[model samples]
Target chain A: MGKTMSEKIFERKVNHAVQPGDLVIAPIDCAMGQDGTTPLAIKSFLDMNAQSVFDHHKIFFVIDHNAPSPMESVSRLHDEMRSFAQKFGISLFDVGQGVCHELMVAKGLVVPGDLVVGADSHTCTYGALGAFATGIGSTELAVAMISGKLWFKVPETIRINLHGTLQEGVFAKDVILFIASQLKADGANYKAIEFHGPVIDRLEMDERFTISNMAVEMGAKAGLMVPDDKTFSWVKKRSKRDFESVFPDPNARYCEVVDLDCSFLTPQVALPHRVDTVKSVEELDEIPIQEAFIGTCTNGRIRDLEVATRILSGRKVHPHVRLIVAPASREIFLHALQMGWVEEIVQAGGVFVTPGCGPCVGTHQGIPGDGWNVISTANRNFKGRMGNASAFIYLASPATVAASAIEGKITDPRKYLR
Target chain B: MSWRGYAHKFGDDINTDYIISGKHKFKTLDMNELAKHVMEDIDPNFYQKIKPGDFIVAGKNFGCGSSREQAPRALLAAGIRGVLALSFARIFFRNAINCGLLVLECNTSPIQNGDEMEIDLLVGKIYDHTQGVQIEARPLPQVMIDILQEGGLVNYFKKYGSFRGV
Candidate 1:
């Protein structure tokens, strides 16, 4: 049988033909741990009594989860991470650098056809560049740091073909939310999803990143797209690394095929406590929100900011709502500032925070009050996701969030769109 | 090896966020401190109700969301001997195995809250002492068994010098 994208990537990594369900120990191109997981990984690394990391250049430590140290205890963990990074001579992306996954891709640390792993679930975000990336636990990350190699059970592939153009104000977030509704939480357990068809090809790198970032929400090991000219140019602008892109054979064997027509899709929202409980924004009743957030690894890119900015430019935030905007990285933040998107957003009563995962991870900054409702563009909507189990989180597109912020209710972005 | 515990049953899609909330993640990394808050959102008194060697029984998709190892670590610290679910999110399943916490997939519907249960790791069987019945569980692969036998991946790495059964 012809090989799928993941199978092809694994075959190349191991330098042998492989099939689904085969376990192979392959060298990892890059491995990372964020502040939330790194401390535990350091503990496990010491517990293993490892003398040194396999390679300093291949491992990274990022401090974005609880950036700037919300408290003394978190600060101590940050210090521990800094010390470990210094001792091992590994690269450290300190606070405000951005979310770990965004920094990894923005820095070009990962490329097509490479095997990558991170200690955060959204590490699957890198698959937008066609890399076979997935998330593992801190202990597993420790193993990767020591050996630069990890074993994997080659997962079967699920091919999702996206056809047609998205409607006005609908975006990659909507597409992913719609998919999540159909697939549910555990739909793609232990499997890799390869997105294909015209819609995927037409999507920009930022949109692709948003889609791939949420693959983990569907229980996918990796959500990948075939690297095309756009992907190549995007990576080339960021890094001078020589890399090869892998694609599935024409007759590739997929366990299942899902075809989605994006033309019919509308602004989607995942209600409180469950990502799979998605509905079209227009179909929902007047669900008032106390906060509207536009940020995170999922939708914190420049394009995402531009969309939110366009919606909030002249209109003030609703009296009952707080609009918070955080760019995915300092680079994106500076770019948005140059474009005047930040000023316009802030002028419209949106609060701009440091470019990191603060409110999204609920470490510090902008957490909702108890019994409040929040509309966010972040990926997951699991119970207590935003640090307050009593508060509710609704997942939507950046445009939708901005619209909702303007009205203080779950409003469709198309109403604001010209 | 066998483990006996009272089942602390829960419903479907019990994500890691519900297992341990994000608010507590930054407050402390001490497993014991985290243990006190384990499942606090789902059941406020969860930690107080379970004794040493207890089990968490739940429906489908147990331990979904995020790659936080703290979820399993906290459960282990809270004296949860094992988790029996209809299924698990992929990352959580691997994390549980890496932490040396027992995770089994079976028809957890047959298990009830506070039921006395025993799990035979070698035989892949769960005996519900309270229900007076037994159920078969999905068996772990030899590699996972090897890692779990050593009380987690770190110990397994210390003993074997590399991952085995790959």
Candidate 2:
């Protein structure tokens, strides 16, 4: 009853505690920017008479959506962003070292218990590190850029406790997709989610990120994880900058706590129209996949590729299916190369693309033609979220996607897991 | 918070991109400049010019994408006095109040454009400002009404910083 993770987080880095009906100004620990929205945010800041950023140290920018390939206008936008960062002294992640959320995790920009606001909705991904991170509009982002403060309504939180070990071949993506299917997109409307359980301890940083990344698909403001050894070690290694550990008080009370027997979860996928339209791979009959893309902030990680490579070692993509593999980051790309997963993916008659937000935003690469049925590794499969509004994007775990890519349809990943 | 403008009606699920496209997401570009082309993507003539004091009626998830405070900034600047939606996207709802834009969440959907609305923002009612037009919408919670009355969350904080750590 005293404090939840949300209250505790606000209590620390903020100027004060967050009570009902109380509006407080808190210093933003990290401000994330991406190419699609950051340029406009910076432009608005300039228009508002902000000569320089209030504090560059707290600001961060990344060019994730259109990286590795800079179309003319896109290149200009990047240049504009570079100039904005230079003018305001904000550190820019131009190389797009990784997906913005993954990059923030890897770069140590987000620490457990830090309050982060990102121009992109997925900024809520940092809540995986135990921070109260939320997404904001570019206009509000600009305000945060100049004022270092914004207002928030303390969202009602629903706590999910994962109690058992995960089934093999079922990674964090499946766990989240299953959760979304249960909650339905609007079930948790205007709520914050705190994910806790024993299984969370085993998930890698990127895996935890994948869980928190898709939280927005459930209509949640953010998804949070409590600080653990993973949080401490991650902050120490990446941030190289010192950070304090924050947690919910021992007697904290949650509005509701939903317990899960993760061992009960299998490879899951969201059909169409909503992330909540969940169906297990085995439940569907003869569902042929037109395409399979394995990457995004959701499942684009070293482990994801490693699991996929094992499944695709000697197999070729179905003659009718086009399979695309994108590493989550340059670091992951280089790591994949060294580990031979890159070669495995290529030898399987699949296309391995660059490390950016391509298929996810339907921008750079992997464009889905109309009526295309794509089982993707990205977050949302909302109507028209991909290429054509009519294109049916089904969200799934990397393993399920890999198995389906081989079978040319949605197949249960358990066939290959053992 | 003084309610001055007339009402404009629009259905919900009005995304930020719909409010202002990604390409046009720059600040200091006031609402009048933005409202000029409001819904140009959806309806090319929406913002050529609009009535004052009109409200936007949204179906569900109004202001759903990009947490940029600009969506409401442009709407409020353009001509909208308040937004009445069956539901509101969480972030946008916060930003609207924080930035002093009025957003009212009303249940009972299917808001038609022709239904003229009279909104009592203080009381959280959206009666047909138009005579002979009857529409249904749920009023807001009292706590939300109070926050709005103080001219947005920040102003409320300024007057009573007690609820938050100041």
Give the best candidate by DockQ.
Answer: 1
The fraction of reference interface contacts (C-alpha pairs within 8 A across chains A and B) present in each candidate is 0.87, 0.23
lDDT of 1 by residue, B43-118 (tens): 9999999899999999988988889999999999999999999999989999999999999999998888999999
lDDT of 1 by residue, A1-418 (tens): 8999899999988999999999899889999999999999999999999999999999999998888788999999999999999999999999889888889999989999999999999999999999999999999999999999988999999999999999888999999999999999999989999999898898999999999999999899999999999999889988878998998899999999999999999999999889999999889999999999999999999899999988999989999998988889999999999999989998899998888985987767888899999999999877678878789999999999999999989998897887
Docking tier of model 2: it is acceptable
Q: Over the stretch B1-166, how does candidate 2's per-residue lDDT look in tens digits? A: 3343344456545666567654344322345666665555566677655666667776777777556566777777777777877777777886787666778777635445655666566555556644444444456555456657775544554455323333
Interface RMSD of each: 1.0, 5.4
How do the residues A135-219 of candidate 2 rate in per-residue lDDT, one tens digit apiece? 8866567778777876666777788888898877788988898888777665566788989888888888878988988787766
- Can you tell me which runs of candidate 1 are displaced by over 4 Å? none
Deviation in angstroms for A59 in model 1?
0.9
TM-score of chain A of 2: 0.96
- Candidates in order have lDDT scores of 0.92, 0.74
Query: How large is the interface RMSD of candidate 2?
Result: 5.4
